[model samples]
Every structure is written in C-alpha cells, then in structure tokens.
Target: MEILVMGLNHKTAPVEIREKLSVPANEAMGFLKRFEQKRIFDEQVLLSTCNRTEIYGVVQNHAEAVDAAKRILCEYSHLDLASFEDKLYVLKQPDSVRHLFSVASGLDSMVIGETEITGQVKEAYLAAHQNRHTGKVLNNLFQRSLKVAKNLRTHTEIGVGRVSVASVAVDLAEKIFDDLKGVRVMVIGTGEMAAQLLKAMTGHGARALIVSSHHEERARELVREFGGEAVPYELFEKKMGEVDILLTSTFSSHCIVTENQVRSWMRARHDKPLFLVDIAMPRNIEASTEKMDNVYLYNIDDLKEIADKNKALREGQLETCAHLVQAQTQYFMDWLFKEFNSKIAASGS
Candidate 1:
C-alpha cells in the first residue's frame, strides 16, 4: 500500500469553498463509515478544520482511491466535481509524510507557526484510531508526525510570537478602539478561540466582558475564570447592542447574527462603532452585516492579511523549520520502509 494525502486548504481554495466540505468533529465517525463503505483505502484519517479538509490514507491502488475520495467529497459537499477538481492536491509517499509534518508543525498553516493545527491533527487521528478505522500504517504515520511537531516547537523559534487567530482579532480590536481599556467586549461561544479572546481582552484591561454559549454552564465557567457576566444564549442579540466589540466562534450551521438584527442593534446603540470578529467556519455573522455603517466585520479569511504580515516577519525561521521537517520526513520514511519490508518478509511475499 502507498501513503497518500489528498485535500484542499486555505491556499488552494477560498473559505466559501472550504466551508462547503468541512466535517465537524461530532460527525467524523459518520463520515469515516461512509468512506469505508466506498472502500477507497485500507486505512484513512479525515481532518477538517476552519482552514482545510484533507484525507490521509494508506491505500492499495492510489489512482482508484483518489478517484473514490473525490467522489465521496463531491457527494457529501454537493459541489460539482469539475468545479473543484483543479483546487485539490495529491501527495504521495515521502512527500505525503513531509506534508503531514509541515501541517502538524504549523508550517503549512494560514498563520505560519500557529499551534492549533497540531491539536486538530491529533484529534482527527484519535477519532479514526478509536473507531478502528485506522490500522498499523496510519497509526505509525500520525504518531511520528505528532512527535515531529513537538520537536519542531522545542528546537525552533516558530512558536515564539502571538500568531493565533484570537491574538490577531484582539490586535484588530485594539487598532479600532485606540485602546481596549474602556471597551465592552461580548463573546459568543465558549470554545477555545472564544476563551483566548476573552483572556486577551481582559488582559488588555477591557472594561466589561460578557460571554454567551449554548451551554450555559460553560459560559458561566468562562465568565468566572475571566471576570465577566454569563448571558444566556437566547439573549445574545439583545445584549449585543451594549457591546463595543463582538467576537463569535459558535459551531452553529447558520449565521447567528444577521444584517437586520445588526441594524436594530445599531439603532439601539445610536450608531456606535461595533467591531465584529467572526472566526467560525460556517460563519456566525452574516456577510450582509458588513454593509452596516460603523460596523466592522471580519471573518477568518479577512484575518489573512494580518497573518501574511506575521508570516513575513517569521520568514527568517522558515529555513530552520524546513530543515527540521526534511530530517523528520526522512526518518519517518525510513521507518515505514523497514516496517513494510519486515511485513513482506513475514508474509513471504
């Protein structure tokens, strides 16, 4: 069998296209079952995040598997195969292993050196492994990739700065308000990103903080940890009019904040400037809300400009990261080859 990776990411397609293919963590097992029914590969791992969706697998026939994988994606996304074929990329063997290393190490991320992808990759691997969708080949590959990621972070300067989406959003908030000191920040959702945003905002001395989430306990926990009030989900919109900055990262399928709602909130606020940062995948805020006066709306893609500047600043560290990935990739391939040869000998093939 051959190790292969096929997918599209932030670099290959825009968020609009990427969102169409995103598989939430809760639905990963169902996706794996569907893919298994197709028999595309002997073992496979599906990774879907805010920025990318990829399938890494060990397959008997690379050509057949790739075709089937594409078919599966098209079927699930309801997107025409022809429309997205050019956007997909395929990598084989050592190159595939190298790409995994780059991704786990954050070198392949939209924000170069950002650490969230490491956890996301691990989560994907665990989901597959726990469900018995992965075997020896994928188990070894993912384990080594994670080890490489840890070594890269330990031995290099790639993770030295505030390169996270949350940090960038806070920076943007600071730029808009001139200072976060007196700003009333409201965060919807209690995910990691929302927690990070709350911490950053409070650290910068934001006057008031309010957190809302589907899970009221989680919201209250965050508020207790960061000195904020916990508002119930039903009242998020009603409370929005009083906030100077609104940050949302909910996992809802539809937009939580709409143009008409914002218009009403704006009227209530007397046209106060409201900076909205929506870092959700399907997007928590409506696109039409961007047209509202004095309301600044930014999604994950909009943060790419800030990410690009940070990427340039960290360009000097790329050579060191590249060398580390090359060394680790070679190490992984050598191990894989030995394992493959040993198996062949044992089977007398």
Candidate 2:
C-alpha cells in the first residue's frame, strides 16, 4: 500500500479558506467514522487545526485515494470542490512521510518550531486508532513521527524562544500597550490557549484578568489558578468596555462577538483602544469588527507576521532541523520498505 497525504495549510490558503476546511476536535471522530464507511482507504487519520487540515491514509491507488479524500473533505466541510482544488496539495510515499515528520516537528507551522502541532498530531492519530480507523501502517507512521518530533525539540535549539501563538499574542499586546502593568485582560474561554495567554499576560504584569467560559466550573478553576475573576458567560460582553485586551478561543460554530456588540461597548469606553486576539479556529470575533476605528483585531492569520519575525530569529537552527528530519524520514522509509517486501514474499510463498 502507498502512504498518501492530501491537504492545505496556512501557506497554501488564507484564513477564510482554512477556517472553512477545519474539523473541530469534538467532531473529528464522528467525521472519521463517516469517512471510513466510504472505503476510500484501508487506514486513515485526519489532522485538523487552526493552521491546516490534513488527511493521511494508506491505500492501493494513490491517485484514486487523493481524489476520494478531497471529495470527502469537500462534503464534510460544505465547501465547493472547485474552490479548494487550486489550494490542495497531494503527496505520496516518502514525500508524504517526510511531510508528516516536518509537521510533527513544527517546521511546517507558520511559527516555525512551535511545539503545539506535535500534540495536535498525536491527538488526531490517537482518535483514529481508538476508533479502529487506522491499522499497522498509519499507527507506525504517526508513532514514529511523534518520536522524531520529541527528539528534534530535545536535541536542537528549534524551540529556544517565543514560538507559540500565545507568546506571540502577548508580544503584540505588549507593542500596543507598551506595558502590560495596567492592562485589563479578558479571556473568553479556558482552553489550553486561553490558559497560556493568561500565564503570559500575568508574567508580563497585566493588572487584571477575567475568565469566562460556557462551562462555569472550568472558568472558575482557571481563575483560581491564574488569579483572575470568573465572570458568567452571559455577562462577558458587559465587561468588554472595561477590557483593554480581549483574548478569545471558544468552540462556537458562529461568531460570539460581533461588530455591533463591540461598537456599543466602544461608545461606553469613549473610544479606548481595544486589542482583540482571536485564536480559535471557527473564530470567536466577526471579521467585520476589524474595520472599526481604535479596534485592533488579530486572528490566527494575523499572528503570522509576528511568527515570521520569530522564524527569522531561529534561521540558524533550520539546517540542524532539516538534518534531523532527513535522518528520521530515512529510518521510517527503510522500515516501511522492509514491511512491504516481507508482505510480498509471504504472499508469493
């Protein structure tokens, strides 16, 4: 069987397109189950994140599998196939394996050397394995990729500095406020990203933090740990006028904060500058909000500029990372070829 990867990422497409193709973590398992029922590939795993959505599988016919994967993605995302065809990339065999290793190592991320993608990749693979959608080939490939990612980070200086989206967001906030000492920050969700943002903001001496989530208990827990006040989800908007930086990452299909809502809040604040950082996939704030004066809105795509600067700082580490990726890819390819040859010999005997 041939290993294949078909997908698009932040480099290949814009945020609008990437958001449309994203499969939320909660919905990934059910989507994988439906995708497997179609029988396009023997084993499959879907890796969806704010930056990219990739479908990896083992199949007999590479071309047919690529087409089927694209079709399934279009159906699931409700996006037209014609719209994505130009943006999509298809990789086979060693190239596919190399791409997976690079992604797991965070070389493929907008913020080069960011470590979050490794966990995202592991989670996606585990979901597929637990549902029995993946067999020996994919299981081995993902497991090895995760191992290579760990080794690369441990041995190299790839992740030595500010590389995550959370750190970058804090960096941007610092630029606008000049100092976080008197900044009043409000986090809309208590997810991993939210917690990271809180920690970074506090470390920078942000004066206050307010945590709000659909789940009150989770929000309160985060507040307790981070030294913030937990506000009821319904009242989060009411506190908007008092907030200088609004960080949001909620699991909502639609925008939780709209232009009209922010416009009304701005009136109360007398046009105080509001920095909005939307780190969610589906996006918690509406795109139209960016047009408002004194409203600084940054989405996942907007973070790319900051990430690019950080990438430049780590340019010296690229050669070392490339060497690690090459060595790991060769190791996986040798094992894969051996497995394939052994299966052929067994069949012949």
Candidate 3:
C-alpha cells in the first residue's frame, strides 16, 4: 500500500485558484464517494480550506492513484488539469507523510505557526472517519500527525507570538484606523475564522460589534459569547453601510456581498472609508469591490503579506518543529509497513 497526497496551497496558488476547489464539507463527501465509485483508492480524506484543498488516499499503484485523483479534482473544480497542474503537487509514500505532518503542525501554513490548521486537519480526518472513508493506515497517520502538532507547540516557541491570521488581519485594520476606538464593526459570518477574527478585533476595543450569520442560532451564539448584538443575516447589506470595518468569513457557496451593493453602500455613507476583510475561502465579498473609492478590501493573501513580517521571528524554532514532525512521521511509517508486512505474511506471500 502507498500513502499519497495531491493538493495545492497558498504557496503554490492564490485565492482565486484555490477558491474554485473550496466547496463546503458536505460537498467534499461527493469527492470521497467518487473515489470509491471509481475504486481508485480504498481509503480517502478530503480537506478544503481558505488556503488549500487536498486529497489523501492509500492505494496499491501510485501513478494510477495520482492521475485519477487529478482528474477527479479537475472534474469537481471544473478546471482543466493542464490549466492548473503546475500548481498541484503529488507526494508519494514518506513524502506524503512528511507533508501531512508539516500541515497538521502548521509549519506549512501562511501564518507559519497558526493554531487553526490543526483543528481544520482534525475536522477533515473526523469527517472522513465518520463516513467510513478511512482505514488503519490513514487512521494511525492522522492520529500521529495530531500528536506531532501538540509536541511542536508544547516543545517550541512557535506559539509565543501573534501567530494567527486573525491577529494579522486585525493588525492591518489597526494600522489603517490608528486604533479600534469608536470603530463600528460588522462581521458577516459564523465560521471559526469569523469567531477568531471577532476575538482578535474585540481585544482592540471596537465601539460596536454587529454579527450576522446565515444561521440565526450560530449568530446568536457568537453574539452571546462575543457580547455583540445579533443582526439578521438578510440585513447585513443594510447594516454594513453603518459600520467602519466590515469583516466576512462564511462558508456560503456564493458571494454574500456584491460589487454593486458595496458601491451603493458607499454612496449612502457619503464616501466614509470602509475597511473590508474577507477571509472566507469562497469569499463572501466580491473581488471587484476593492476598486471603489474609500473602500479597502483585503483577503487572505493580503493578510499573508502582513504575516510574513513575523516569519523571520519564528525561523529559530523551525529546527525543533522539523525534528518533532520527522520523528512522528517515521513512527507512523514504521507502524504502517509493519501492518502491511503482517497482512502479506498472513496470506503466505
């Protein structure tokens, strides 16, 4: 059996490219089902987020699995393989093991040592596990990968700084406004990114917090925890014009705010500056809205630019993180091939 990973991340591709493959988790189940339907790989897990989308599988033949996974991802993304193949990386065996360990440990993230990727990786694995798409090999691999993350965090200084994209986004907002004082904020989503962004911005002391969610219950929960006043999802458009900072991080499949809508809102505000931060994978705000007067729009890639400033600070700890992940990867591989050898011997091979 072979461990394989096919994916693209913020390093290899930009948001516009990655977003095309950023379907909701429910939709990712279809990718797993297709892999099963084609009998390409018996074990599969799909992970999609703001920065990357990956397909993990264990198969007998590496070439066949890689080609099939590429075509399947192209079919799901409606993108031609030749068009995006240069951005995709196909990792095999121990390399795939190393890649996943780096990811779960946040070494591969744009934020360098973000805590969010571990949770995201765990969610992806659990979803596959509950759907019965994972087996012993991947089971041990993911579980070990998680432990590697904890070991790196506990043993190193990677977690000691402003190491989250949310904090980076807030840093940019503060630079723009000088401070958060009396800055009205409207956050239009209820995902984890939304919560983190809200938490970071709240620490700066915003004058108001208006939260809207596609699901009312989640919005109410955020409001209660963040001490924000909940607003109806449909009214986000109307309320957005009233705030100085507009942050959106939702899992909606379509744009929640359009260019035309923002143009209209700007007119109603008499050209007051509106700082918009859209960290959602599919992007809740339209891309074209960035062109309008007094309208500042920043996405995940923009936040990455700010985060790069602190990457040098964490480089001193990379050796420690690498050693931990490499040790974990080897541990997984030893167990993986041991199981394979046992199965082969049991069959009298």
Candidate 4:
C-alpha cells in the first residue's frame, strides 16, 4: 500500500476556496466513510481546519484515490474540479509523511509555530482512530506524526515569541490607540478562537472585554475565563459603542455584522474609531465596512502581512525544525517498509 494525501491549504488556495472545501469535524466521518465505500482507501483520516482540508490515506492505488477525492470534493463544494484543480495537491509516500509531520509541527501553518494545528491534527487522528477508520499503516503514521510534532516543540525555539492571528490584531490595535489602558475589547464568537482573541487583548492591558456568541453558554464560558461581561448575541451590537476593538470568528456563511448595522453603530459611537478584526474564514464582517470612515476592518487575509513579519522573526528556528521533521519522516518511512515486508513474509508462510 502507498500513503497518499489529497488536499488544499492556505498556501495553495485562497480563503474563499479553503472555506468552500472545508469539512467540519461532524462531517469528517461521512467523508471518510464515502472513501471506504468507494474503494478509494484502505485507511483514511480527514483533517480540516480554517486554513486547510486534507484527506490522508494508505491505499493500494494512489492515482485512483486522488481522482476520487477530487470528485468528492467537487461534489461537496458544489464547484467543478476544473475551477480549483490547480489548487489541489496530491502527494504520495515519503512526501505525504513529511507533509503530515510538517503540518503537525506547525511548520505548514499560515502563522508558523501556532500550536492550534497540532491539537487539530490530534483531533482528526483520534476521531478516525476511534471510529475504526484507521488501520496499522495510518495508526503508525499519525502516532509518529504527533511524536515528531512534540519533539520539535520541545527541542526548538519554534514556540518562542510565537505570533498568532490574535497577536497580529493586538499589534494593529497598539498602533491605532495610545494604549490599551482604556480600550474596551470584545470578541463576538465562540470556541478557542474567541478565547484566544480576548486573552491576547486582555494580556495587552485592554481595559474591558465583552464576550458574545451565537450560544450564550459558550459566551458565558469565555466570560468566566476572561473576566468579561457576556452579552447575548442579539444585543452585542447595542454595546458596540462601549467596544473599541471587535474581533469576529464565527461560522456564519454571510456577514453577521452588515454595513447598515455598522452605520447605526457608528452613529451611536459618534463616529469613534471601531477596529474590526474578521479572523473567520467566511468572514463574519461585511467587506464593504472597510471603506467606512473611522471604521478599521481587517480580514483573515489581512493578518497574513503581519504574520509574514513574524515568520521572518522565527526564520532562524525553521532549519532546526526542518531537520527534525526530515529525520522523523525517514524513521517512519523505514518502519512502514519493515511493517510491509513482515506482513508479506507472514502471508507467504
């Protein structure tokens, strides 16, 4: 069997494309099962994040697997393969293992050294493993990938002064205001991304925080952690004037914060500056809001510029990380070969 990966990432595709192709954790098992029923893969794991959607597998026919994965992705995204065939990546064997190692180690992230992807990788692996979707080859591969990721973090300076999307927003916030001493920061979303933004904001000495989410319980959870007020989702806009910086990371397909609402909010603020950070893939804020006066809007793509600067700062750590990944990948590959040889020998006997 051969190891194969058919996917797209932030580097290979834009946010719009990535969002279209992204498979939610709830939907991953269905996709994995589709591949099994289609006779595409012997072992499979579906890994999806805001920046990437990758299907990794151990299969007898790499070419057939790649073709089927593409067709399935086309059907799922409601777009033809021709529209994004150029963006799709199909990697085989040792390269596939190396790519997984790099991704788990955060070397392949939009913001290098961000720790979130490692957890995502583990989540995807375990989900597949628990569902009995992964066999000996995939089990060994994923376990080794996690080990390699841990080793890199322990041995290298990759985590030192790590810059994330949240930090980038904070950096921009610092430039806009005299200081965060009196700034009222609010995160209008749920999950760790929401918590991350509030943590970064508060850490920068922001004076207050308002947590809001589609679910009040999730909002309360963040409020409990961040020492903020939890505003119901419908009422968050009413508190916009009290909010100096508003970061949005939601799963909404359309803009939750629209231009008309912003107009009213600005009137309420008396045209005061309101920094808007849309870190969500589908973008929770209206794109045209960036053109409004005294309203600063930055989307996920905008964060990349600042992220690139951070990448430069962490460039020194990359070579060491590279060496670690290369060595671990080779070890995994050797073990794979040995496992395959032993299986063949046993079958012959």
Model 2 lDDT at residue 86: 94
**TM-score of every model versus the real structure:** 0.62, 0.62, 0.62, 0.62
Candidate 4: global Cα-lDDT?
A: 0.84
Q: Tens-digit lDDT track for model 1 on 3-96?
A: 8999999999988889999999898889888879988888999999999999998877778989989988898899999888999999998899
User: Which is the better candidate, 1 or 4, if ranked by lDDT?
Assistant: 1
lDDT tens digits, residues 1-349, model 3?
7788988999998787899878688787877899999999879888898999998998877788888888888898898888789999989878999999999988998878888999999999999999999998899889888888888888887775564588877777777887887777888778787788888887788744556555778877877777768887767666766688988887889988899988888888999888999988988889999988888999988886656656766777889888877888888878776879765344334
Clashing pairs in 3: none
Please give the distance, in angstroms, between residue 198's alpha carbon in candidate 1 and its true position after superposition.
5.7
The whole-model lDDT of each prediction reads 0.85, 0.85, 0.83, 0.84
Tell me how far the alpha carbon of residue 251 in candidate 1 is from the true structure, in angstroms, after superposition.
Answer: 34
lDDT (Cα, tens digit) per residue for candidate 2, span 83-151: 888999999878999999999999898778888999999999999998899998999999999999999
Q: How do the residues 46-98 of candidate 4 rate in per-residue lDDT, one tens digit apiece?
A: 99999999999877766777888888898899998888999989898789999
How displaced is residue 76 in candidate 4, in Å?
1.5
Alpha-carbon RMSD, candidate 1: 12.3
TM-score, structure 1 vs. true: 0.62
